[model samples]
Every structure is written in structure tokens, then in C-alpha cells.
Target chain A: MPTVHVQLFKGRTADQKRAAAAAITEAVVATLGGNAATVDVIFHDIERHDWATGGKLWSDQPPAPPTPAAP
Target chain B: MPTVHVQLFKGRTADQKRAAAAAITEAVVATLGGNAATVDVIFHDIERHDWATGGKLWSDQPPAPPTPAAP
Candidate 1:
């Protein structure tokens, strides 16, 4: 069983998660040779205050530019 | 930098997360020769419906017995 943990800034919709879960499962099965049913993709939505880089929390730093919408 | 992802059933208190983060950081530093500050321990609070084992979703299975309190 292949378990994947994806960490990203919070606020993604359920639809995003659903699509991601399916895409991830497909990748894992294609590359790692595992059953799609057995692959687990868990998403961790981390708050900006909780994540730090170079000793400064993301909440304290300048906000990152928004991600471009998918085609 | 070493990053750790911990997946467990949801509903744990903030104090529990604080304790777990400290303990896991210590373990990683001691065993893997990493700086404690650089070790990221991200906890994923998984819902029962999102997790499965043996082809059964945890939410669909019988309730698990409560964990005994630590001394």
C-alpha cells in the first residue's frame, strides 16, 4: 500500500481534494505498481502561522502571490 | 531539513499536538543528526471516512476501543 501525504496552505475546496486524490492515486499506481484502491492520499492543510521558513513564519512574511488558475 | 508527516484520527487537543511535536523533534534530532528547528512535524488529522484499511473505510468499520491514558 502506498500512502501519500500532501501538505499545502489551507483553503482548498473539496472538489480540489477529490481531483487531487484521484490524480495522485493514478500516478502512484502507474509508477509504483500498486492497486489504486489501496493507495491513500491524505492532504494536510497547514496554516500560515504554523509554517516557517528561514526562522520566519509564513504568516509573518510577505504573502505569496496567488497560484494561477488551472486551465 | 527532515520533514515528518503523522496521520492519526482527528479530535486531539492542541496540548497533545505540542507534546507530540516536541517528542518527535527530539527523536529525529537524536537518531538522524538533524537540527531540531529544521525538523518539521506536520500532523494530518484524518477523518474516519477518509482513511481505509483492508478494503473498508474506517468510518464504515466498528468503533475502535479507546486508548488507555498514559501515566
Candidate 2:
């Protein structure tokens, strides 16, 4: 069994989440040959204060909106 | 909007995925004040070859089963 974890700054709509989940699940099950029943997904909304990259917390970065096309 | 991504080695029942998704969605919505619609969860099953930690691929590590209690 394979469990995939993804981490990104949060910003999406409910419909987008649903679409992404369904797409990802299907991709994993069919393309990856993973059992559909064994797929597990979790999302964690991170605060800029809690995230850091290059020695700077995300909170210190400029505020930005979601870019659906990026993912 | 906050997008939360979670990845782990795969080995979960369909029921577990459903339960986890619901629980996580609720936690994000209630505890974090995130919108239910924007909560996205995606799972990737890692091949021992594809995942690495501490310079060792996961596949090289001992084969282990899921420890549901660990999170």
C-alpha cells in the first residue's frame, strides 16, 4: 500500500477540493494500481506563522491569494 | 482559503479513508474556521523507490504496515 502526502499553502474552493480529491483518487487507483479502498488523504491548513522556507516564516512573506492553476 | 495536503505510505481501508476525510474536514472547518468547500485532501501511495528520508529511499527501509494510531 502506498500513502501519498502533499504539503502546500492552502487556498481552494469546495468544488475544487472535491474535484481534486476525486481526480487524485482515480489517478492513484487506476494509474498507480493502488486499491481504491486503501487510499487515505488529509489536508492541513497552515498559518504563515507556522511555515518557514529559506529561514523565513511564511507569515513574513507577502499575503497572496490562491492560484488554482499552479497545482 | 487554506489548502491542506497530507502524504503517507499507503495501507488503509476504504472505511478508514472516509472516516479520516470526514474527521479532517470537520476539524479544519470548526477548529480553523476554514470553509468546508475549500478543504482539499489528496493521497499518494509511495513506492519504496519513490519516497526518501534521511538519504534513504522508503523502499530500502524495512517493510512495515500502517500504524493507524500514530496519525
Candidate 3:
């Protein structure tokens, strides 16, 4: 069985998770040709305190400047 | 950088996690030859309801039969 685990910052709604699972499942089935039933996508909702990048915790990172929307 | 994700049943102590991270990091560094500082082993503690095998949730599986001790 092919199992995929995704760790994302928490607070996503169930709809978002369901959509992600469906899309990822389709991609896995298309690429690997496994029964769609056997493809499992497990989401780990992570708090900022639990994740770090470049030796710095996500919670402690400086605020990112806002990006302008395209006209 | 290679990122490894491990999904395990919850309730492991911090010491167990530290040991696992150390061992897995060592193996990855040995085989892949990356800086040990950059090796990340993210653990996702899965609830029985969140995991399934053979079209059934782990939470709903029948109780496992006891195995006799082997001398």
C-alpha cells in the first residue's frame, strides 16, 4: 500500500482536506496505476511551534511583506 | 534536501522519538550523504480512526489474537 503523509499548518477546513485527498488520490492512481481504494493521504495538521525551516521555528519567523495582487 | 515523513500510532514518549530521529537521520546521512543538520524526520501521530487497512479503519478492526511467548 502506498501511503502519503502531508504536514501542513493547521486550521484548514474539512472541505480543503477532502479536496486535497481527492486530487492527490487521482494523481497517485494516474501515475502509479494502483487501485484508487488503496491510496491513502494522511494529513498532519501542524502547529507553528512544531515546524521549523532553516533552523528557525515557523512561529518565530518575521512577518512576510504583503504581495500586491495583479491588476 | 531529502525530507522523510513517518506516520505512527500516537503515544510514544519523547525519548523514543529522539532515538528514532537520531537513527533515521544517521541512516539517511550515511546512504544519501547529506549534512546531518539538514536531515528532517517529521512524525505524524495517527489516530486509529485516521488510518485504515484493507478497506477497514484500524479502529474498527477485530481484536488481534494473542501470541504465545517463545522461549
Candidate 4:
């Protein structure tokens, strides 16, 4: 049995997840030659603050503030 | 370099996650002999409703209601 774990940002709907799971299962079965029914695709939603790249958290990215009107 | 992806329920504090990451990194380095810095332990916090087992969603489990005594 192949267990596929997906790590992604939170906020996806159930339909989206279901579709993704189906696609992943199909692909794994096709590539690895196992029954699709046996494959498990689990999704893990990561909060932006908890995920970091190159020692910097995603949530720390600077936001673009609105430009001030000329006086 | 080894990347460990942990799938678990939501509600872990930052301190808990930090401890887990450190432990995991150390273990990976000891077992695989790779630089600890290169080892990544990413956490994916999942809601109970999003996770399932044996075709049943975990959130669907009936909660134990308050016990009522005979009047």
C-alpha cells in the first residue's frame, strides 16, 4: 500500500480535496502498478506562519501597503 | 538531506512543534548521517473533519454527551 502525504496551505474546500485525492490515487496506481483503491492520499494543511523557507517564515513576507495620497 | 513530513491533528503549540522538530532532525542525522541543518521537519496541522479512517471522517465520531441522572 502506498500512502501519499500532501503538505499545502490551508483553506481548500472538501470538493477540491476529494478531487485531488482521486487524481493522486489514480496516478500512483498507474505509475506504481497498484490498485487505485488501495492507495491513500492524505492532505495536511499548513498555516503560513508555521511554514518557512530559507529560515524565513511565509507569514513574515512584507505586505504592500496602500500608497498615501499626495497632500 | 532528509525531509520529514508529519501529519497530525491541529492544536500543537509552537514550543511542542519546536521540540519535535529538533528531535526529528537529530534522529535523521544520526540514522542517515546527513547535516542537521539540511533536515527539515514540516508540520501539517489537520482539522478532525478533514481527516478520515477506514472511509469514515474522524469528525463524524459521536461525542459523549453530558450524562443525565434519573429525576
Candidate 5:
């Protein structure tokens, strides 16, 4: 059994998780030769205050700019 | 940078997390020769229903017996 652990910022919708789990399972099965039913995608939601980079907490830093919409 | 991700059953207290993080950071630094300040220990609290082993969900199984107290 192949288990994938994904760390993500909190606030992702259930729909997002569902889509991600399906896509990840497909990719893992295709690339790693595992059964789709045996694949597990576990998500860990982290808050900004709990995550840090370069000695600075994400909560203390300026928010990232929003992604631009494609034309 | 070395990042340690720990997945555990939910309901852990903040004090437990603090102790775990400190101990894990110390171990990683001692074993791997990394700065304690640069090490990251992330805890992921997972629900029983979300985790499965041997084709069975943890929530569907009987609760684990409590650990024995020290003599």
C-alpha cells in the first residue's frame, strides 16, 4: 500500500480534497505501479501561525499575492 | 532543511505537542547534525475514519486497549 501525506494550508474545501485525492491516486498508480484502491492520500491542514520559513512565521509575514486569473 | 511529519490520532493537547516537538527536534539534531532552529516538526492529527489499514478503516475497528500503567 502506498500512502501519500500532503501538507496544505487550512481552508481547502471538501471538494478540493476529493479532487486532489482522485488525481493523486491516479498519478501514483500510473507512475508507481500500485492499485488505485490501495492508495491513500492523507491531508494535513496547517495554520499560518504553525508554519514558518527562514525563521519567520507565515502568520507574521505579508500574505502572498493572489494568483492572476488566466485569460 | 529536515522536516519531520508525524501523524497521530486526534485529541492530543498543546502541552503534549510542545513536548513532542522539542524532543523530536533534539533527536533530529543529534542524529542528523542539523541546527535545532532549522528543524521543523509538524504534527498531523488524523481522524479514525480517515485512516485505514489492511482494507479496514480504523473507525470501523474496535478501540485499542488502554496502555498499562507503570508498576
Candidate 6:
């Protein structure tokens, strides 16, 4: 069982995330010899305010949050 | 600062991992508005014996490990 955890800055479409998961799962199964069903992918979305770089906060100049997840 | 940890089966080239990291970092920067330098991607190679799913072990039917990372 291979668990892939991806922490992104929290502004991607569900379709993008799903595609990423599928691509990663395929890579694990074909390249790494992992069972497809056993491959687990989790996504953590961080708020701009919660993310930082070079000791600076992203929320300080936060880009407007993208539209909510497509319903 | 966001740190992404990926637990993969213990057999992939360093270059492959590096590529994966770069792609992910690009996605984070472009899609999620994260800084490129601050994106950290860590890969943990787990022994098949250490991984399990559906109450079964991966090591029991382990596929042979792949070639070592390119020098």
C-alpha cells in the first residue's frame, strides 16, 4: 500500500485533483508495482493565510479565493 | 510553507522523483499560487513488508525492485 499525500496551496478544481490522483495511481501501479486499489491519494488544501514562503505569509496579499468547488 | 510527503513503494529513480517534484511544484505555483523555492516534496520509499492493505501484505507477493537511481 502506497499512500501519497499532496499538500497544495488550496485552489484547484476537483477535476484537476481527480486527474492528478489518477495519474499518480497509474504511476504507482505501473512503475512502482503497487496495487491500483491499494494506492491512496490525499489532498490537503491550505488557505493563503495559512501558507508561507521565505518567512512571508501568502494571506498578507491574498489572491481572491477562487470560486467554490463546482456543484 | 507547505511540505508534501509522498510514501511510495521502495523502488524509483531519484530523477523520476525529482521530475515528479518539479511537476508538483509547478502545479502549486501556477494553480495554487505558491512560491517555487518554498515548495518541499519529500519521498519516502517503504519496504513492501512495511505496507499493507485490505488485511493483506505487499511483501508477500513483492515484485522485484527496480534499477537504482542514475548516478
Worst 10-residue lDDT window for candidate 3 chain B reads B49-58
Cα error, residue B15 of model 1, in Å, equals 17
Candidate lDDT values, in order = 0.79, 0.55, 0.75, 0.74, 0.78, 0.65
Higher-ranked by DockQ: 4 or 6: 6
Best by DockQ: 6
Residue pairs in clash, model 1 = none
DockQ of every candidate structure: 0.15, 0.10, 0.12, 0.11, 0.11, 0.24
Best-to-worst ranking by lDDT: 1, 5, 3, 4, 6, 2
Where is model 1 more than 4 Å wrong at Cα?
B1-6, B11-44, B48-71
Q: Candidate 5 docking category?
A: incorrect
Off by over 4 Å in 5: A68-71, B4-71
Lowest-lDDT window of 10 residues in candidate 5 chain B?
A: B13-22
Candidate 1, true inter-chain contacts retained = 0.14
Colliding residue pairs in candidate 5: none
- List the per-model TM-score of the A chain: 0.88, 0.67, 0.82, 0.81, 0.90, 0.77
Q: Higher-lDDT candidate among 3 and 6?
A: 3
The positional error of residue A23 in candidate 1, measured at the CA in angstroms, is: 0.7
lDDT of 4 by residue, A1-71 (tens): 78777788787787667656666777777798866656656777889899888999888977448667455
Give a tens-digit lDDT track for model 3, residues A13-45: 665566666677777778988787887777778
How close is candidate 5 at the interface, in terms of C-alpha RMSD after superposing the true interface residues? 4.2
Candidate 2 chain A lDDT trough over 10 residues, lowest sum = A62-71
TM-score per model over all chains: 0.55, 0.44, 0.50, 0.50, 0.55, 0.59
Better of 5 and 6 by DockQ: 6
Model number with the top TM-score:
6
